[model samples]
Target: MAQFLNKLIPTALAIGTGISLIDSSIYNVDGGQRAVIFDRIAGVKEKVVGEGTHFIIPWLQKPFIFDVRSTPKNIKSETGSKDLQTVNISLRVLFKPEIDKLPWIYSKLGMDYDERVLPSVGNEVLKSVVAQYDAGELITQREAVSREIREALTKRSKEFNLLLDDVSITHLSFSQDFTTAIESKQVAQQEAERSKYIVLKNEQEKKAAIIRAEGESEAAKLIIQAMASGPGFIELRRIEASKEIAETLAKSGKVTYMPNTGNVLMNMNASGK
Candidate 1:
């Protein structure tokens, strides 16, 4: 029984060792991932591996995985504008590794290539592009500025074997003093507009007053001519005035109108109350 047990134990141990070796030798490069092999003796192999189960010699070789998928990164930069004003800027970059250069990327920059290259290159491009424009242009010509940065950054990234899918300016800000100056300028503009409106209104009112005075003078002249011609206009005006007075009394509800007799009877009862 002891002899049988010893033989069985060696066989089981060998089987377990074989299983572990096979497991370690096999690896799956998932979708959106690529890999490069690192040989114990040869350092890093030049050949790149694609997504699938791939084999490497156990204990003598290792696989370094890289995500070939596009990833987003935010970069912030503070630099001086062309006008020497300090500005804070933010950028959003979508980046990935160049699939064909995976081995070189792993050999040189390793897993965090984006982290190392993007910030430095991004800041350099941002400062360069921003320095070319005044602080106002950064806001006014924002698209042009972003395009310039994108072009520069894309070119710079390619030199490092990194691929940038998209680059955009996300945020921009200036010093508090500059912001306050802008607000003050806006307020001044509003005040100037208000002043202009007031001047226009006063001029219109003055013209209206002049027109009214001219109309009153013309009416007085017409009245003089009518009076010189005959007394009919004066009599007509008196009748119109009397009619208006009667209507006012009637609307007060304290007088009874006698239309044919041309008389108004006051409500003595209302007057007593």
Candidate 2:
């Protein structure tokens, strides 16, 4: 039992030492990661490597990893419009560190580059763009404003070895009072439009009525002139009316009966000659 114990102890110690050595010497860089090498004696080195396994003298040099994949950052900023109204803006930026300049970025800005730089630069560009337009234009021309901000950020981000994938203005808002004012203006405009429509409709109706009245008056004049041009029209109408009355009386069976005398007599009462 003593002999077995001595051999097993050495074997176990060897296995543990081997594992420790492997753990220190080997390092893996994941996909989409950028790693920079730093030496204990010489300080940070310019050598930068991308994804996969990497080797360096253990305890002499070390690796710092950075994700070069596209990442989104949110920025909430408050600025003023051209009309001096306070505008609150929410924005998103898709960005990544330049792979080739990973070492350079580490040397200058360190790992906190995103926190230190992107917000200030974005806010500056945002304020400048907002200052160029009024509050109303900001809503109407949002796409234009976003495009301008992108162009400006691109130019500035390159200086810091940051590649900007995209810049988007996600939200634009005004104070409660301003929003209420806008709503009131819209309502007033709608009301004015309705009033104008009603006035036009009433005018149209009045014009139509006048046209009908004039048409009736003209027709009456034409009829009177036609009747006047017919000669003996009144007398002809009277004779036709009498004949119609006689026919009506005969048909009614209420015609009066009267005795007819052969000769006319001037009567001398009670005496005949």
Candidate 3:
């Protein structure tokens, strides 16, 4: 019975040791790369699980994990315009280390890349570009500002082995007095334009009235000249006018008086005889 118990104890001990080895031999994935570090044992690459795990190393190389995801850096600065007015600008930058150049990034800029590089580049780009524009231009040309900033940052980031995804202007602030003055000037200019239109419209109406008057005067002169042309023409026109009057009276079922010039002529002839 003692011999049997001793064999069972050894078997149990061996099983427990195997279980411990299995637990500690997991693989660790770093920086989204398949590159992994082993914990204590070697040749454990086959045991790697999805994306991340603990692994056994031969105690020679140490592992450092870097985040492979896109990171954001927010920066703010005060820049002077060409007009020498200080404007407060805030920007948010999205960037990440170039995967292919990660080794150079790690070597040159180190882990505090965001802290050291982002602010300096953002400020330099913003201030340099803004200094070329006046306060009014800066307010009106937001897209230009964004483009210049993006280009400047992209160029600067290349040296640091960074990939610039986007640079966004989050906020801009100018003096209240400057804003009010600009608005007031715009309003005055609009009012002047409206007044000029009104004056032009009035002039057009005056010219149209004068043309109508001139047309009416010319028509009256033509009618007077036609009437004075001859008595026969006048009598013919009177007869036509009388016929039109008779037609109108007939439609209304009314009688109109007609002068008898033939009777008057007969009486005059009998008197002469």
Which candidate leads the pack in lDDT? 1
Report the backbone clash tally of model 3: 14
lDDT tens digits by residue: candidate 2, 1-273: 999999999999999998887788878999889899989999888878877887888889889999989999998899999998889998899999998898888889999889988998889888988999999999999999899989998888888888999899899999889999999999999999999999999999999999999999998897677678885665776899988976675565444323364432223332344
lDDT of 3 at 196: 100
C-alpha TM-score for every candidate: 0.83, 0.78, 0.65
> Which tens-of-lDDT digit does each residue in 156-232 have in candidate 3?
98778778888888998877787788789999999999999999999999999999999999988987887888677
What's the ranking of the predictions by TM-score, best on top? 1, 2, 3
For lDDT, candidate 1 versus 3, the one ahead is: 1
TM-score, candidate number 3: 0.65
Query: Relative to the unseen true structure, what is the C-alpha lDDT of residue 233 in candidate 1, on a scale of 0 to 100?
Result: 92
For each candidate in turn, give its C-alpha RMSD to the true structure in angstroms. 3.2, 13.3, 9.8
Candidate 1 worst ten-residue window by lDDT: 257-266
Q: Compared with the true structure, what per-residue lDDT tens digits does model 1 show for residues 101-178?
A: 988888788788888899999999989999999988998999999999999999999999888999988899999999
Check candidate 2 and list the clashing pairs.
none
